[model samples]
Target chain A: MVRWEPGTPERLQRAALELFATRGFEETTAAEIAQSVGLTERTFFRHFADKREALFHGQELFVRAFVAGVEAASPTASPIEVVAAALASAAEFFPDERRSHSRVRQSVIGRNPALQEREVHKMASLAAALADAFRARGVADPAATLAAESGVTVFAVAFVQWLREGEERSLGEIATEVLGELRALTSAV
Target chain B: MVRWEPGTPERLQRAALELFATRGFEETTAAEIAQSVGLTERTFFRHFADKREALFHGQELFVRAFVAGVEAASPTASPIEVVAAALASAAEFFPDERRSHSRVRQSVIGRNPALQEREVHKMASLAAALADAFRARGVADPAATLAAESGVTVFAVAFVQWLREGEERSLGEIATEVLGELRALTSAV
Candidate 1:
């Protein structure tokens, strides 16, 4: 059996975020992050493709939460209803503890146009995956695409609110409220 | 006064697309594309930043359609209604004459990942501008952001349908029809 490296990525990610936030993302090197975490640069590369990837350590988990919600949704739910579940699930990935890290990460991302483009790309990928999940559940055509895209958009809007100062609500609560507003918006048409 | 060059950009764009399609985007060069249209490299660069940009000739006009629709929308219209008008207006940019060129251009864009990222960035910029327009008209924070983002997403989905082989309907018709489906999807919640 192969040796398990428990929590190595988590340690590296925590160290990298602190470094990136305090010293600036461009000033921080992968080797420095690894060294700060008491690991080699080779270990860092093995865990992440690069330092940027390390900051996005939870991206897969973020996507998985959405897919898991889709799978857990009722068979007879409407397309929008299924997407609602996905958003609720995705929000659960952000607890009280992770908010500060996310805020710092967002600031770093906002400072760099390339990182902003990567954020858009990541949302596009999430939408595509959710569309496929909707299709697998027997939803069809524009409904699937529309629901998935809107859910991801709602998540983006609510996540921004969740990161804003003086906002005390949980991500899931904010997402659900925003989703209700979205429903009201579409229904207005 | 500047000299009038009414058709120069159009000519260069067409020549560039034709050359890029035939010669492969990598194999094509700016100087060669300019020569293909009987223009010089200097003239081509004046019109477009580069060869890649020449292929995306109508991107500005496309975004303008969305913004124009926002401006032209009835003041009393709901957020979703305003977005519907925006979709209808955006669809008008893709007339029967432009469909063939769009098909070829999309194929060219699809071949390059970097170009695909550029498209996403362009859409994000378009959404931000639309959000500002909505806010100018008295819409509030999350709603403006959500409406703008959703309208852009709808356009993306409907545009893909418009580009599909053997699809006969105009982009406006398809977009309207898709918008109706989106309304129904959200209402089903």
Candidate 2:
């Protein structure tokens, strides 16, 4: 099994995404990924169980930080405000230097049907986590589910816009703009 | 390979859900499904290619109707309004009589990971179809993608509520409520 060391997991993930996009995910071996990153295959196995796992390793921590941020936000904030706070907190885990790599990773994952399915599962789990957090915070009826899913919508839209802009603006700014568009879209209806 | 006649496919689907929920999706055979519905194995094969497909056939028509409705909506309507109109049109296809069988289908599908994955894929496809419809209209930006995804969210929330209410309310009303909740949540930020 690959053990993920601090910083190494992300480097391996980036390397894997690059290789996967270039060589195709099915064609690229874990050994090739490790060698390209100047790490041993054993180390790669240590970080991720397999190539597929590498694409999703960051999501565990991403979910935790996001839910924490939502739970920690002021109780008085609106549901969307709470979700936006959560997204902002999760955003800290991503580095500015890696936006291009992030875009590449998204593209690679997007092209693969299997990877896309797993991505959907990941998003669903994150929405469930957010809903649970909202429920714990006393939001009832449709608010918890609506806020969680709406937050996911905002995240997806913002991330795509961020990719399209290609470092022209900060991630936070893209997120804000997407949220504004969503607000306008919803309210204008 | 199979083809569904007018009413036979829905009957087979209903029968399959009942058997799947009582035994299991994997444990149930086409013969058993057909026998329960007072049909033959050949008849079952005529309506569904296999057991798994019976669970999913309606989704295609549902998605097609959703896209068509979105495209036919007033161009002046906002993205959210367009989504709402599409959902309303889709809801018309799911009458009160189908809700019980639908809930059974949901429960059966929820018990299996493969079925859940298939469900997610179907939903994603529906979202993609909706996005394409939005793109066909004048609205640009990632609005198509955002609206499509948000429409799925609305559908999910509404479907769950409808399931809980057990045919007490029309699907259209539930969908409208879910859309309103989404709008409220987004605007509250």
Candidate 3:
């Protein structure tokens, strides 16, 4: 019989990130995160499966946006074009306000090998999901998988550039630019 | 005093792969691996940092071949061409004799989330190493990174296809074919 509060998830995430940054991800506990936000451990569990999951709260939304973008694109669009469109649409999930938090989050992830592994797993899952989206649109093998993987690669490169200190480019702009480079590289052979 | 044994590392690796396959990766222990090889735990540690590393023994050789291939390529070659040539050369490291063991290894890795993460990390490290090789060759930032990442992608797709049952194509042949497909895909846009 616990009371539900608005913004509890966001509050927990913010508190977890702060504690992880200050005390390190391995040292931070779910209980400490709950206590920081004046909530119980049960409430925190209601939002996140574990302390590590808090940092990846946006993953589901990002995947959904990417898939939906691919599904909604014109059927006549090429695989790479579909991937580019999906990336552009998914870029909206990371608003400007999240930039500093993301930068901190990347640093936290960078410091821990376990977290780095989790990051790679997440990217692999995203690529698989995007590939499935392509398949659903009747795109065939190899091309679908390649385009999806390339999309994830573009997102990764663009996200890093966007997170750089004092960088002003939007995620969409950077992703498009990176995709263009990929296309140019692929075509160069 | 420890008796030096010839082929201790290779024997331990073979024992580890067999045990990991028969008993499962998580259920297998370092002590068991050492016992199976009639080697001391100290000998095992001298070869591998941990049990997980045994599955990735070829990674160093693979990276060395990739980097050497890139270095040996003509300076005027395009980034994609350099990457393709590197992948083709690196393919020589995975001969037909290793196919069955590789297949088993991939299955063991596929069944475990932690192992899958390790695989992704290994691939990411390879890509980073290739990118560094490109940079050493005087290639610029984004292009070097993009080409390296794309090369890894090509290798992954080709490797999977080459691993299919009844597949007779050599790794180099498969990689070259995949690279050709990538070129067509990119040029189609």
Candidate 2 Cα outliers beyond 4 Å, as residue runs: A1-15, A29-50, B1-15, B29-51, B165-167
State the lDDT of candidate 3 residue by residue for A16-130, as single tens digits.
8899999999898899999998899999898888888888887888899888889989989988779888998889888888899899999999998877888888999999999
Q: Candidate 2 residues B43-147, lDDT tens each?
A: 999878888888997777888889888978987888888998899988988899878878888889889988888888888788888888888897786677888
Off by over 4 Å in 1: A1-6, A38-43, B1-9, B38-51
Candidate 1 lDDT tens digits, A114-156: 6788889999889889999999999988888898998999899
Point out the worst 10-residue segment of candidate 2 chain A by lDDT: A162-171
Estimate every model's Cα lDDT from 0 to 1.
0.88, 0.84, 0.88
Q: Write the per-residue lDDT of candidate 3 for residues B73-122, one digit (tens) a residue.
A: 99999998898889978898899898898899888888888788888999
Per-prediction TM-score to the true structure, in the order listed: 0.90, 0.85, 0.93
Pairs of residues clashing in candidate 3:
none
Error of 2 at A189 (Å): 4.7
Better of 1 and 2 by TM-score: 1
Candidate 2 overall lDDT versus native: 0.84
Using Cα atoms, each model's DockQ against the true complex is: 0.78, 0.67, 0.72
Of the candidates shown, which would achieve the greatest TM-score relative to the real structure? 3
